[model samples]
Target: MFLAWNEMRRNKIKFGLIIGVLIMISYLLFLLSGLANGLMNMNREAIDIWKADAIVLNKDANQTVAQSSVNTDDINGKFDKSEGLKQTAVIATDGKLKENATVFGIDAKGFLMPKLEDGKLFKKNNEVVADHTLKTKGFKIGDELSLSNSDEKLKIVGFSESSKFNASPVLFTNDETISKLNPMFKGDKINALVVKDKNWKDAQLNKDLEVIEIEDFVTKLPGYQAQNLTLTFMIVFLFAISAMVIGIFLYIITLQKRNLFGVLKAQGLTNGFLAKSVMSQTIIIALIGTLIGFGLTVLTGAFLPEAVPIKFDYLTMSIYGIVLILVAILGSLFSVLSIRKVEPLKVIG
Candidate 1:
């Protein structure tokens, strides 16, 4: 370890370059994770907050929640015969305050709608809740805003924080009001239904309606799979780059110390010690680089825009940190493979 430390100290520029590369790659990975998680949360936070055990939609609607429509009668007999039901909808409407908002039409009386950050839920027709961010965007109680895509208008009745779906702001309103605005809706069918009952067999429920567990429904959101896949690729490529950079840096430094290593070997130092020293040096460099990258990410996230869709979670951080250390260690081991081949006799003969 002392030998490794001294060798790294002697070639500060080379070691610094390696650390710089690792820091850049790790920073990119952390940012990508945040964007992916943030976008997903922005897209589905309200639905996740619903905490529904299961959801039912039209089988023909496929993966789109907005496209799926279930009639009131489809769930009436099934809901009453089973346990409970909560119908939900995602509507694209012009903001009552902002110009364009992707609103989530939730039944005020249902399990998904009454969570308020300020004001209250709809108690009468034409009432709606706006996202807290919209409060600054110019929406207030009793304000009537026109929908951009449709001629229908919605009245802001309350405020809430869980407003935003797929990186767009959300509004919570009764199903009737949303249906009244949407021409496709016959004032009867719902976009989706949340079912709660232990006795209700999912397979049987699917026979009558397109039934899927709540968690699964979340993954079905458009662009979710592709976004996640892209982030995964970024993270994987960064990790590989980190490993290779550290390895190559260490290998170059070791080569520079070939004569010194030969002298140490002649003095009876073991190849194992040399390898351990190399690993220690790599770890030290990696730790410093990672800590710096992590600190920068935290600071940047603090001031990011609400619409930016960035989430920094502990699980992701923990996993990234562990992988970073391991990659650095692996890189050191790889470089050390050349250590055993350095012969003292060849240099001093």
Candidate 2:
């Protein structure tokens, strides 16, 4: 360790360059990871808030929520004593805020809906609760928003944090209002049913409907699977590249010190000590680089635009950091192998 420190001190510029490269690559990997997580949350945050164990969709809909249709009567009678909630979406906007928001028609007493960030849940047909994102787009309590293609207007009574679906803010309303807005949906017809029972497969239901785990349901959302798969592949590729870069950098550094290592070996230094020094140096450099990268990522998150979907989770970040360090250590094995092969007599001459 002392020898490794002395070498680093003597060649600060070379080590500094390698550390800088690592910092940049690590920063990029973390940023990409944050974006991937943020986008996934944006796509499924509203559904995740339900905390439901499983979702019931019409088998004919092919696992898609939007296309599925459920009759409230069937769900009520078949799943008696079970908490089954109906939900659906419609394209809506307030003219000033023109985006295709998903209107969720849920029972006010059900557990599927999330608590409001401000104000109360819907108590009437015309009252609605929306995601916090709506507030950012010029909406507030008492503001009346209209649906697209219909003259019906709903008053925003509350806002919930992180309540977004399919990249759009969610608007919670009652069954009555949704039925009034869309003639095709009458009485008990709903897009899907959310059930609290994890053992939904055992529940006796019409053969036409299928039960799917909530986590699996999220993947069925349009483009959700594809987007996540692509980003995950990119992250994996970056991890591989980082490992290779570290391996090459340490191998070259080890080569430059071949004569010094040979002399030390001739002077009675054990191979284990030399290998430990190399690994210790690699770990120190990796730790410094990872810290700098993570700090920069936090700073970037702080200044990022409100419109951009980006989230920083400490657990995820920690996992990423640990993986990076492990890969770097693995990369240092090449240097250890090179050290073991060093011929003390040949290099001393």
Candidate 3:
């Protein structure tokens, strides 16, 4: 331990550079994990809170909430208790709010309405529930807004937490208003039916109406699977790079101090003590750098804009921290083995 402490003091700059690299890698891992988790949450949180056992969509429409179409008959015939929703893209603009927005027309009295964080749910044709981000972006209650897909000018009736789907802030409205706005909709039907019953028989559902689990539907969103996969690959490669960087730095340090190690071995120091010291130094450096990096990530997250989705939960951070420490320990083991190979006889000659 004494020898390891002395070596670290002797080569502070080299150790500092190694520590800097480790910090950067650890920070990137933390950021990427948060990003992946955040994106998934943004796409699915509203659905997640529904606590519904099943979601019914059009069988031919695949899993998209926006594309699936189900009539009242499709739902009333099978589902014990169900709410119809029409997830469509209609351009909306408030003369005062500025910028055109995509609207998500849904049933005001349905299961979806309960997710509203503030104000009242949509009740009238003129009423709409906007996401919190939009409120910051320039929207307010009682503000009259015009929807482009249809002829209706609506009013903001409520606000919801940052509910976003396909990167667009969601706007909640009654099914009647949505049916009037969306041109693609054929009848007074919904894009999908949110089912609350667990005993729903999929076989008995209307042949055209497909019953999809909410979890499965979330993955079907365009680019969701691809985006998630790309982020996962990036995080994994960074972890590998972190391990290699630590190993190489310690290896080079051991080589530079070979003569000194030999002198100590000849002076009655056992190889085991020298090896343990090197490992202890590696672990100490890894721990200090990781902690610093994690702190930086937390601080940076505080300033991040709501538009830049980054999710960090305790479970995700804890798992990543554990992996970082494990890799650092592996790097230290290499240094310990190298220290053992330093021969006293060679140095005396």
Task: Evaluate all candidate structures by whole-model CA lDDT and list the values in order.
Answer: 0.72, 0.83, 0.78
Residue 196 of candidate 2: its Cα lDDT? 76
What lDDT does candidate 2 reach at residue 252? 96
Q: Model 3: residues >4 Å from true position, as ranges?
A: 96-102, 183-188, 200-203
Measured over all alpha carbons after superposition, the RMSD of each candidate to the real structure, in angstroms, is: 3.0, 2.0, 2.3
* Per-candidate count of clashing residue pairs (backbone under 3 Å): 1, 0, 1
Candidate 2, residues 1-349, lDDT tens digits: the string is: 7877887898899999888988998899899899999999899987887777788889999887778888767777454334434445566566666667877777766776777788888898889898899888778898887766678888999987768888888888887887777665776687787877656777887888888888888988888988889989998888888889999999998998899999999989999999999998898888989999999999999999878998888789889998998888898899999999999999878
**Backbone clashes (count) for model 3:** 1
RMSD of 1: 3.0
List the candidate numbers ranked by TM-score, top first. Answer: 2, 3, 1
**Candidate 3 on 76-96: residue-level lDDT in tens?**
757677777777776667775
Estimate the TM-score of every prediction: 0.89, 0.93, 0.91
lDDT of 1 by residue, 107-223 (tens): 566667636888878767667787775675666776786765556677777888755655566777665666666666665666777766554443355454677777787787877
